[model samples]
Structure formats: structure tokens, C-alpha cells
Target: MCTTKRGKIVGYCANELPCCDFTAKNTGSCGTVRVGSSSSPSAVFQSPDYPDFSSGDLNCNFQFDISNVSNKGYDGIQLNFEDAYMEGPGFARHSPCETDMIFIRGFKYWQPPAWCGNLTGYVAVIDKTKNTAFLKVVNILALMSGFRYKWRISVSLIKRSATSKNSETEMENMENELYPSPNINYADIQPQPEVRQSESRSNHRSRFHTKRHAPIFSDNSEDEEMDPIAEPFIVNGEDTNITDVPWQASIRTFYPDSFLKMASKTINNTDKFNQEKEGCSMEGRHFCGASIISNKHVLCAAHCFHGMTKLYGFKRLDHVKVFLGETDLCEDDLVKYGRKSQNYSIDKIIFHYGYDDIILMHDVVILKLKEKIKFNDYIKPIALSKRNKVYYGQQAKSSGWGLTNLTAKGASLPTILQSTGKMFVENKTYCDAFLEKGWAASKSLMASYPKYYNAYESVFCTSSKNDSISKLVGSGDSGGSIIVFDKTHDPPLPVQIGIVSYGLDGLESKREHDNVFVDFFQSVSFYRDWIDLAMSV
Candidate 1:
């Protein structure tokens, strides 16, 4: 220790007891690490002895400030943990949250959950909603064993003009202009279900329905009148008012055990050289989309349930959450957006028992929420079509947080719900041709599943009409609604005609005619009886 000129001791100040916990002190220059407004835009932080840290009551805090970059129009910071190995909760090793936990703060309105054990190389955290975040690490009672952890953060500070839609102010202005009030006059747009269809046009093949079974839904009581939608506001994929697609729902999956495994495998196989490579996609908490059919139930594609098996298995209802009246999943400050999001745990997953994952048939599932959803302008259920005929070409709408760009190999998700107009194509021949030739040639799974050899039955087709512009559902759009207008109703109610299923890749040049792509949707008409039965139970 150095001595002062006045003969007094000169040393760093140290707070006592709790303040000066084991890991709290700056041991080996591994104290509170700060990035962003610090010396660099990116940084690497680690425990005192990473890969071999000591034990017993370890605790420290790390902070990040990205306000400077955010003010410059940057999206936010991306934080990734490269390695984490510590003494886990003894008998409670199964609960990583209770061990030598790492706590996070300021990521959003709520406190970030604790993480412990070997979390390195498997964690990627992004702070897009706020400019700052706090991270704390704690280890308890393991002097014999040690701990290890490492982390890195990179910033995304893309510069954009004030007029760009990405601008915060621009988004606020658009939201206010589009929706002057929280609740639209839903009662005024009530549909007249008693209206009769024209006998002449009814005889001609209508482009609205082609299901074997008639429309099926619970009887409407006088107290509950189905609202009408005269015409859907069609546009290019962009953020819109939540009330625009009241039936739309965002599905999030949460399974800590499987998520950790996926993350670790991804990190172990990837390196800095190939980190940004396409197809090496990162999964978000919100994985798929659905559409509300009733206050307690929402409908989605059955295949969506199949894909989810890899994460939480086929029957993990607790791992699923349904978010209604949610337009933007990226929005961190929910209060700023006047969020009316209602999140509910799934009580049951009513999937088609005959659903063939390989053939992709009977691809429909109804999620029953533990609690019923309260109806509002932004949380209404879409009507199921009653017709059974479909015209060759008819206008419809597809909405979800799917891919915004068609050509990109791994497209980023749209921040807000993306809505685009599509046209139904009654071309069983075209669908069969692709399934027999195009799809069969590329996929090996077709050989094992004979039922998938052709698209002859139980499916409907849609495509982007404009050869130059694309507007079809992509990966994350699975289980979303394909709504069509029924003019037969008094006020023209928007009815769900189909649900998003498998589709020809929008990037496939062969499928494009003058640059247009085709997509397949599970006919909701055929699945109406299944839905009604499931909802009834």
C-alpha cells in the first residue's frame, strides 16, 4: 500500500459487510463492466476467475448504457453469454433459477428471471425496448467447487431518417393518426346473420368456402352480437392498429430446459466467422401466431404443434402462452403503446387426433385458455364461414409477425403485425403438380409418408397476385388466419376461410410466375366441425 505525503494511509475505499460481498469487490479487474457509453460500443465481461472462479457468496453488478446510440436511431444492444458454469442449487439442481443465479434488470418493465449453472454459449439477450439494463451475478456456498461465466455485447445502431417508420416519433404519430380512440364502434358494424343469399349466385361456385362440413359455431345469444367488417384495410406488410385484426394472436413458448439445450448447441457449433450466416436462426420467445375463435379458445395449425414438440414435447401446456390484442412483440415499454395485451396460460391443446405430421394433413389445433378473454375492440373473435363453395380467385387477408422480405434467406420478424391482401387460387391441379414434382423432388420425407405424395384433398391454395410484389405467409405466420369477406351477411362480416399451413418457399424461382409465389392453407371449412367439437368440450 502507498502512503500519503502527510504520512496518512492512502488506499481505495471499501464498504462493509453486505456492500463488500465476496464477488462485489473488484477482484482481478472483473468488477462492474460497463459498455455502450463507456470506452467502446461493444464489450466482453466475465466472472473473477472465469472457467475456474472461486466459491462462497459471490455477487456483482454490471450495467450497460445505449442511450447515445439509441438517440442516434440505433435499434438496441445484443447481449450473448459465451460460457457459464457455476455451483448449481444442490438438491435443487433442476431449478437453475435458484442456484448461483444471475439477475437482470431494466430489460423491460418486469424483472428479468434468474439464470444459473452452465448457461454459457447458450444465452442471447437483446434490449430493444430500453436504452439501459442492469445485470447481477450471485453464487452461494460452494467453496470446494468453483464458478465460471463469460459474456459479450454488440450494438445495432443503424442510422435512419426522421421520416422512416423505424423512428420512435414516427411510430407514435402513425399510431395516433390511425387510431384516434382505443375502442372502435364495434356494435355499429354488427353483422346480420339472418340475411339470405342470392339463389342464382349461390348456385355458382363461390370463392368463400369449400369444406365438406357446413360452418359450425356456438349459438349467439342476444347479449353477444357478432361484429361486422365491411372491408379489411389492405396494405403492404407494416405496423397497424391492433383493432385492424382483432382475432389475431401471438403465441409464445417458454421451456427453460429445452431452450438452454438449443442455445448451448447453437453456440458450440457457431463461431464469430459464421455468426451472421443465414439459416442459423435464433428463436424468440414468441414463436408462432394464432386466431381467436371464442373467448376461451384460439385456433392454429396442427403442424405448429408438431414443430413445438422439439422444444417442450407434444403435451406441455404449461410452456405455452397466448397473447391477445398484441400488435408489437418488440415493444418493451408496453405502457407507452397503451398495451391492452392479455396473456393467458393454456389449459389444454385440442389438436386433431388424426393429424399426420409427415403428410401435414388435418393440421388444426384449438388452444383452450385457462381463463376466458374479455371482448373489446382489439380482442374480438373472427367468424367462421358458412358457405361451402369457393371461386377460382377471390380477395382475402393474411396477417401475422411473419417474414417481411420474401427474398432474404433468414428474414427478420416484423415488429408489428403485418397485414397483406392475398387471392385464393382454386387450382388443385397446380397444387398436385407441385406436390408430385417440385416438392417430391426435393424432400425425402415424401417417400416415407405416402399421404403427402399429392395435395389432392383437404387443402386450399393462395398466392400473391402481383408478380412483382409478394404477400404470403412465411415461417412465423403459421396458424394465423386467412380471412375473407362474406358479402351475403348484412354488414359483410370477415370470416376465416383458412389457416396457414405449409407453403412453397417464396424464394423458389421455379414456383414464381413473373415473380410470384404460392402458399397452401388448411381449409378451415373442413375443420369447422372439429373446432366446434373441441370448443364444446
Candidate 2:
């Protein structure tokens, strides 16, 4: 354990972990492993010889493994040049084909093989999100150019279904089968929805909701019928202030199934949400379900995100992949329909100061994008009622890639669509009517509508005729907008009147009044000033 003149280990390069030395790390030397005099170069050395056979034959199916891992061994990394996934790097096992008791080399994130050392840029992750946790390769050049090197990879995000120990048995006969089917690959799918003439567009359409439906929330006791004054805030129409509350961007995520009667949907009907047809992709991932307001600004729920600051030590735009207009989401289908999908990065997310939970301040957030998106048939923003006119029994579309009963286990990303439902706007006085169930009050589900409804400022409450069997909004779906159609306009316009706020639980969403939305806009309208100020700074 001799310290160097620099008071560090022999190979004390501060850049690498263990800080011993890349020389020592790569060397299978016993002296380096032990804390002996280790300073003598010759005595602390072992050869870094690797075999010609790697996990893959040649192509992108590049594979690798860690040597003697379960019993403690080496790690290796695979690199890729594109946005595709990595492959192999499975468990450490004895190589039957190779003699001399060869253990799997570099099973975890370790050294690359002696192949493909000339590749410039690449991504390194092995296996899918199912059997492995995808981690980004830290040092690309070092891993790719070093004595031990492997090929850079580009693969898909799809995972095979069978995860049992018998996976070898199940897959032995099926290893050649590509997952998600050749038909399921996003390669053929549309990144954006298709815009066709409402009639002709329905031709390729398989089956899904036509109209958007409100978050079907089940009544809860914690949701007390309260006065607007119960949750204090300033009132303004189009002119809203930024300092209306304090924690404007704090988002709260909920656990749907944890609570009873939270109106969290169970796998029952396959029609409203097709559990039988497709799978859930955006299941547990983070996405900011948002509403579009005037021009370029978008209003979304604050609790939908932690904001796009840090993701696994990388800076990612942690917002939803915005799709403007579309009937189908399959990128392939969009191409067939002649529809196009444009990509835009999120620039800014402005949450109102009044944002809070249980207690209302401002749950609404406004997003600024990197560029202004062009709107067309399948992609147009919903209209906002600067006034309190669009409400009650009036039908409109509400959509989001929200939770579906059982398909929660599937891989399809949540989506935005429209369904038909009624407006439940009533008098605040009506919320006081009590409905009781044994052990709890089952009375006046409609009461909270008017109870929290603010005629002058907030817009809340939408009801579907069949409350018994319908899809509803839950956790991650918050801050998403409710697209209200205004037939009164020339284009039969759709304007976003409500930003999905909160409810008793994750899946149970209660409508925040439209007046409340206006109030938030009124208070946050000062954001124009903030945006201009922030940009200048």
C-alpha cells in the first residue's frame, strides 16, 4: 500500500474510479489486486489477452459478457453510433465452445472486445430495459480505443416477453425471432398522427376513441366541497401574474392502485382503451401532459414533471414528445397516410406561483418550445375561454396517453385522443348536498363540481353519461389539457379551456374550474414580462 509522491495510489489518475490506474484495472495481476508494494511494474502485471470470438458474429447483433461475474470477474461495454439500443452483455457463463475454462468476460459495464476499434461515435448499453437497466457508457474513446474493444451498437427499445429462468428453454427455439414482430417496429410506425378528411381518414383507422373524454374521477371523501375563498388567489382574466403563488413548478405524482375507490380503472372493458389490441409503452415513464394556450405558450399541470434538469447525469428535455395533429400514432402508418411529424425541443416551462396540492394556488404551467410548430388538420391547439361560457352538458374532447386498466403492463406510450362526455358545471351551493355510503359518504358526487367551481374564474367538472363503464384520468395524466371544441368558430375550432390539475389520488382527477384556469392566466400573464426578462438575462 505504498503511496505515490502525489499522496495517491500508483496509477493515481483522478479521472477513473478506484484511481489505481487504467494499467492496473486492465491487468489481471494479483499484486495490483492486493495492497502489496505494487510499485514494481513487472511484478504487478497480467496479460490483457482476449479471444477472437465475441458475443456476436459480425452485424449489429453484437453481443458480450462479463467474465466470471457471479463469482466476481470482469465487465465490458458495447458502443453504438445511432439512437438504437445495445445488445448482449448477458450473464457470465462458462464457454462450452472455448476450452481452458474460459469465463464470460465483461458481463456488466466493462471492457469492449478487440473488435471494431475504428468506430467514431457510438452508444453503449447491453440488453433491453426488461432484463437490464440501460446505462449510458461514460467514456466512449477509452472504451472503444483501448486494448479491449467491441463494436458500437444501434438497436430498438422493444423487449422479449418471457423473463423466466426457463427463458433459455423458451428462447432456445425462438432466439431468431425479432421481438414486437416486424410489424411492431417503430420503423414502420408514424411518429405523429395522420390528418385525413374526417371521412376518408377513418378508412385505415382500426378502432379507438373519436372524441376526447374527461378524466372519469370517482368520488372521494377527502375531496371536501369548499368555497373559492377556501383556496385564496387573485382573480384576473387574460391578465395573470407570475407571483400569484410560490411553488409554481413543483409536480406531485400519485399511485393509482394504492388507494381504494380512487376511481382507478381496473382491466374490465377492452373497448374504451384497447387492452386486447396494443400494449402500453409510456407506462411509468415521465411525460408532461400539457395544454396549449395562446400562440406558443402551453399550459400544463405543474406536478407532471420535476422539470427537464437531470436524468441519469445527463440533461434531457423531460417533456412529452409533442404530436400536433394525428389520427394514428404509428410512424409507418403516418407515412402511408402522407402525414408528417415534426420534432421540437422544449425551451422553457413556466409554472404559476399559485401551484399547490389540496390547497390551490396555481397548478397550471406554461411551456415555451424551441420553435413555433406549424398546426394542421390532425394537429391544432384547443381554444381557451377568456370568459366562463364553455361549460355544463356541453360536449368536447379530452385526451392523453393516460393509464389503461390492465394494459398498464404493455409497452405503448400513452397517447392523446378525443372522446365525448358531458359538462358537470353546476352551482357551488350544490356541492353541499351529502351522499353517504356505509363507512363513508357516497353522496353528492356532483357536489364537488360546483363546490370547487368558480363561476368568475375557474372551469371544472365534466360528466360522461355512463359513469359506470368509462376510461378516466389518473396520475401522470395531470397538467394535460382538455380540448374543448368551439363549433361557433369558422374551423369548428378546438381550444384548451382546462389544464388537468389534481384529484384525491393519482388516477382520480377532479376538474379545476375554467375560471381558475383564467385566474391563473390572469396572474401568470406577467410571464410575458418574465420571458422577455429571462431571455435578455
Candidate 3:
């Protein structure tokens, strides 16, 4: 008989207590090892005789029940892997758990994959609602002498206050205090720009002109004297007020001087390279768009950072800059807006573990800012849509500072932010059909689309109802948000549903005349659990 204290097996009848009490009658076989409430809130568990080889074949199971703990309000369990060393994948590389592996359960949708080999720095969080969780370690190919495998995991209980649910509400309430009145007139509040009308029109004309059209104002005095106050031409979209889409963010990247020096040696055009170098040094170029999710965290496309790392040497945090609360990038908007527009440095970037560059799977990433943002009327975070909800055929809006014309030879960034008026969520079947046709016609797409294109549902498509060019997302809009209003709220709060991932124009074989203008966005609902987990950490 085993000794018991307060219904918890304290020790065996004769020997010292095991790491955990085995459920089976026999000493060590396949059975659950229950941890009593008397154990510390956080504890480290290790393989038998850790740091040394374990004799004979081994199979172990440990279970943790949060209900038995003193604190019933505990949110979840966090498993931090301090060390792990085991036999890796088989010769075929097909089965990662062919030899030795660790399996974790009770995380529901966020359950991590079976782990093997060196797994230092890995972390997994399991919700307490599941109550009971099991951690199993198995060694299938045990040697005659012994098995040389070891692992150390630190398990701790997490509090609900640290999770995204409360943090999101706190952030929203803090932002609401900054802007008491929602109907404030932005035009009356913002200062008028001091720029000359002619110069402003000239700037607009230069940037918006396409390769197919000659200069709107030529050397002729009559053309130059044309009414300067006339509305500046916009290709397909209209200018949007900063307050209307407060969550919009501009993700900029700067290349170091060392990188420019190396690039100069390879490029033949010294003049063009010199111009690019000047642009790289001053103000940093905007690479992608993002949406503010909280005071310190913003969401964007993972490809914006990963896709350019090789060519641009994006290894340092200092190279990235995030600008918020401003519509115009040309102005000293910080001084003009007075606390409304500010630039922030990134503290950390967390990408979805399953992100794939080739097929653009799970393309979203979260960025934590170095300083907490103070939200105002022109700067606020957008709420995320509920998980597993479908919003098919719903009308949504997208905003960005990307190029308005893709076919234009001398196209440049717009001075003001652009807004796609109303785009509808497209049918997945139709979008897939279009992609298949493109793949059949283009050899480049065929090479990348075969492995994961058909069954992938993590991305959704959007297109203009009238097929207007102005409503399409352009090159620099890769990380912007696809927002839909939740009518359930009294004021109909804007909820983010997607992150701009890629477009048909991203294809290598894309033609200027290609009428298909569908843009793909990383579905936010599908990854809501991952987002919550990331934010909690």
C-alpha cells in the first residue's frame, strides 16, 4: 500500500517519492502521473536521471489539473522548454517523431506539434478551461545499453489579467478617454498646409502621371498657367482623413550605410544608385502597412519583413520604423498635428510559426513597439473580428499609401493616404479558379502553387464590385488591414478581418493589361487564438 496525505500520494510504502505518482499498479508503465495541489505553482519536470542516460525502454506521462490548485481563477498553463536533446527525424525526414518525442495536449486549437531534437526556448500556453493536460515522453528506439536523451520543462500557471481579453479592453478604454467626442470635425481642427497651390499641383502631377500619358503641364506657358487650384488628379482612389482610419500604420525600413556601399559596387548605374542611396538615408522608405491592435502591438504581413531580409540585410531592429496618426508623409506632421502623429520604434516582432514564403501561408505577424502609444482621435487601435466567423460577401474598406497606378513607369508614393471605397469579400471557389487559370498560363506561378494552393483556406480574397482600378491594393499596401463594421455595437465599431498579404500583381508574369484585380488577405479570424497567445507573451 502507498502512503497518502490529504488524498495525495506523498510517498511509496518503502522508497523515496517519484517525480510524480504513477497511476498504474505496476511501478512504471503507460499510465497517468497526477500532480497534487500541494505542488508549487511553478515546477520543473525532467526525464529520469536527467543529464545521464536512462536505462531500458521508456514511456512516461504527467498530468496537471488546474482545478485542484488553490487559485481557481488561474487562466492557463505555460510550458517553457529550458532544454531538450533527443533523436531527430528519421532518414527519410518524413516522421519527426520516429525515435524519441514529447507530446503536449489540452491547448485546443493552439496545441503545439510533437517536439524532438534540440528544443530550447520553445514556449506553449494551455487554457485552464481544459482543466486537465497531459505531457507524454516516449522513446521508441531504445538501445541495448541505454538511451541518451534528456529534456527539462518549466510549467507555470498564467493569470487571466495577462491575456489579450483584459489588455484589449484596457487599451480601448484608455484610448476613449483621449477622444471624448467622436463627431469632432477634423478639417476645422487640422492646420492648413503652407505649401503653394502651384507647387502642390506640380507635386501631384509628377507623382500621378503614368507612362502612357504625356506631362499634364508641358514647357508651354499656357499649360503651365493652367488653373493651379484645380483638384489634383487621383488615379482610382480618394484621399482619406487620418481620423477616419485611426488604426492605419506605415511600416518603413531603412538600409544601413554599409549595405548601400556594398550595393553600389554591383550596380552599373551609379546615378540611379546614388539617388536610391539618398532616399534610403533620408526618412526611410515606407515598405508596408499595418493596423494598430493595442497601444504597444500592431499587426502586419510577415512577408513584409521576411521577404526582404535577404536582399536588404534586414537583421537589425533599428532598420524598421512605424509611423502612425498622420495622413501626409510629406509634412512635418508631428509639429502640425501636435501629439496626434508620432513615429515609434519596434521592440519585438513575432511571426506566425507556420508562415511560408513560397505559398504565402499564415502571412501575418505582430509587432511590439518600444514605447506604449498614446491614442487620440487620429490614433486608435481596431478591434479584431470574432474567431471562426464567416463574413462572406460583406462590404469592407482598406486604406494605404501605396502607388495608385501599377503600369505607370515613373509612379511614386502618394502624398496623402488613399482609401478603397467599398470592396466585397469574394467567393473562395471563384478566387481559386482564377488562380488556377493564372497558374496554367504562367510557368512561374505553376512552380510555386502546386504544393499548397488548393486546400489552403487561411487567406481570403477581395475585389471591387465595379472592378474599379482605384479600389485595388497596390505594391506598398502589403500589410494594411481589411476592416468591416460590426453593426451590433451602438456606434458600429470597425473590426479588422484581414491583413493584406498578396495580390495578383505580385506574380512574376503579371501583365499591365490583366483585368483580374483580386487581392488576397491573411484571414484574421483563423489565427485569433495564435494572436491571443502571442499578445499574452
Highest lDDT model number: 3
Mind giving the per-residue lDDT tens digits that candidate 3 earns over 1-537?
331321224345546654323231222333455553535566666766566434334576766545456355555566666665565544431233555666665432333335555445444455422212332221121211123466677777656445476654664454445433434222332211121111111110111111111222222323322222111122267788788889999887666778646655643123311223332323665657899998788998765664222233222466788999878766656555564577899776665544444445567778878899987778888888677877776777788877655443333457678886457777666455544443333334543433232224566766563533436675567778988765555445577899886654221123332334456777888767667766665
Clash count in backbone of candidate 3: 1
- Whole-model alpha-carbon lDDT for candidate 1: 0.49
Model 1 poorest ten-residue lDDT run: 201-210
- Cα lDDT tens digits, model 2, 1-537, are 322321223434456744433222232211212111112111111112222212211111122222113122112122333221112121221111111111112223322222121222222223221112233212222121122322223222212222322332332233122111111122222211111111100000001111111122232323232110111111111111111110111111222344312222322233443322354322222333454442354556543432111111111234234434333333232454566544445565443322222223234445566677664433444334433353433443444444433122322323333222222332222211111111023234423432222212333433222333333343334555554444444334444455554321111223332111100112222222222222211
What C-alpha RMSD separates each model from the true structure? 22.8, 23.7, 16.0
Residue 460 alpha-carbon offset, candidate 1, angstroms: 0.6
Q: Each model's C-alpha lDDT?
A: 0.49, 0.28, 0.56
Model 3 TM-score (2 dp): 0.57
Worst 10 residues of 2 by lDDT: 198-207
Model number with the top TM-score: 3
